[model samples]
Target: MVFRRKRKYREKIIKRSIWQQLPEESQNFFIETANILRFAGQFFVELVTPPYEHKEMIRQTYEIGYRTLALVSITGFILGLVLTLQSRPIMIAFGAESMLPSMVSISVIREVGPVITALICAGKIGSSIGAELGSMRVTEQIDAMDVSGTRPINYVVATRVIATTLMVPILVFYADALALLGSYVALNLNSEMTISLFLNKVLGSLGFMDVIPATIKTVFFGFAIGLIGTYKGYYSGRGTQGVGKAANTAVVTSSLIIFIIDLLAVQVSNLLMY
Candidate 1:
């Protein structure tokens, strides 16, 4: 009986030791990942089932897309302008100044434009969605909607997600155009390139492959931003503090996701090109 008790105690200790080997952070990460996956699955399910919120979706699109134009415009213009100014001296030294339009257009279209635009949206739209939904959650407004037989997930989550997914690509395109225009302006500051000539060089440098891959990846960036923002906000803990945390986390997570997506997109684009 004594030996059996000792054996039982040893087994209990072994079990406890094994359990303790899994750190709390790791446990939380797994739990959070599972919840996010479940939330995403539910989003897809709700997205397909209808009682579609067309008005809400349209409102969200206007809010996300139109409201962000000024910020995107300024950032894109600066991006191209600075890139051109910085590259000009080097290009001149190498006697490659004439190739500036082609180089700038390819760089902006192939990588920088989509990534930078997505990051901007992630910071702006991601935080807004998180705070808005987090506030609703904290105020028990989401609960009220559920009690009233309104599916908050469908009305709120689906509309916002779809809006971001749709608007991000459009914003990227707009930003790219503005960026090229800015580059043209920069070129004219020291050179005599005509608009027609600049446009010709830019267009001539680009192919379907360059544009298509970049555009395709922006869609993923948008989806990730929206999905992450909604997830952070929807499942936020109660209280104003939680609302703040959700907004902050949403931005951080969405930005990280945008980079990851860009990395994968580059790899895929490279493979296709070869």
Candidate 2:
């Protein structure tokens, strides 16, 4: 059959390491990039316009922020405890046990707190929004909303985005506090570090420069996660399979974007620090 022949020919060309398909892939990437850019532009435009979804946004904030506190707290504590415990041997070898508090505090505030919080949010929240919206699209619920004169973008996308933007920074604050508590707990194991001394050292080591830049970057991270989740879910392919794909791809892609944003944020922070 002609179909079999065409398939065979295509495989033959590919096995020959032909450059014929490279342009197609490049073109597809550009096309996808353009579409995403347009989607983001629409999002911003709708974000500023009137008829805000205040109630929905608030509800989402509670769901996204309050409901996830336990997971974030536990993860943060373990992270801090492990980080301190792992770094302990190095500090002890160098006879820098007294400096452990300051070092751990700086590392948490300047980097670990925001990064870990964002990664967790990306996995928990990003896939959630993506699957929710993807299911709506698959079941034609979004279309029904359109017919009812409801602003799906405003009601769904905007609320989720704004909620994420607000909640992630708050989560980071919790993570930082819990991480410090964990650090204290870890310090007490096989050592006699006092709570007062730990607090004093941590406080002394921190400043506006550490907190402010880290907080600002977290806002951007939250925005990226929400945007990708919303975008992937809103424009997902056809059927329940598409819903699964959307959620899967959203988490993976958003996590990658988080790292990308974090790298850029660190570079910018460094440039500004000098």
Query: In terms of TM-score, which candidate is strongest?
Result: 1
lDDT per residue, candidate 1, 110-229, as tens digits?
A: 999999999999999999999999999999998999999888899999999999999999999999999998999999999899999999999999999999999999999999999999
Minimal lDDT window, size 10, model 1: 27-36
TM-score of 2: 0.90
In angstroms, give how far residue 30 of model 2 lies from its true place.
2.7
* Model 2 lDDT on a 0 to 1 scale: 0.90
lDDT (Cα, tens digit) per residue for candidate 2, span 41-109: 888888998798888899999999976798899999998898899999999999998888889989998
Query: All candidates' lDDT scores?
Result: 0.95, 0.90
Residue 244 deviation, candidate 2, in Å? 0.5
- Each prediction's total of clashing residue pairs, residues at least 3 apart in sequence or on different chains, is 0, 0
Least well predicted 10-residue stretch by lDDT in candidate 2: 15-24
Residue 153 in candidate 2 has what lDDT?
83
TM-score of each: 0.92, 0.90
